[model samples]
Target: MGEACERPGSTEDCVDDAVCATDASETGDPADPVWETYTCRAVCVDESDCPEGQECRGVTGAFATRACQPLR
Candidate 1:
């Protein structure tokens, strides 16, 4: 569910229950500058909908789309 994708891309680019959402996690290497990547992630309504260590997060404004995100 972590496949890289283009911004504002189509949902067809992801799996059946996933969307091309922004990966909110930190970079693999701390030495690297913070960069944003669009990845395929499962949609969720709340923390209960995500995996054990993830949560459903959105920007909390108009047009904000929620997706499963890692808590760490």
Candidate 2:
């Protein structure tokens, strides 16, 4: 299984595309939200793929995973 980087500051060094966004859960479960790893993933760029109130965004300036997150 891929390493889980749920924390904000956590970053994957040396990765070619190590950018990820947070996928928030409604239940507020303790388990971390799934981190979608990607290489120029569509969900990262296409806001249309994101659920309501969430938008596709990058993480840590890296391009590892693109995930859905609430507007900031």
What TM-score does each of the candidates earn? 0.66, 0.37
lDDT (10s digit) by residue, model 1, range 1-57: 789867533467788877776654375665553547777878778888888988888
lDDT for 4 (candidate 2): 42
Deviation of model 2 at 61, angstroms: 5.5
Q: What are the lDDT figures for the candidates, one per model?
A: 0.67, 0.46
For candidate 1, the 10 contiguous residues with the lowest summed lDDT are 58-67
Q: What's the number of clashes in each of the models?
A: 0, 9
Q: Highest lDDT among the candidates is held by which one?
A: 1
Quote the lDDT for 17 in model 1. 72
Listed per candidate, the RMSD to the true structure in angstroms reads: 4.1, 7.8
Clashing pairs in 1: none
Looking at model 1, residue 46 earns an lDDT score of: 81
Model 1 lDDT, full chain set: 0.67
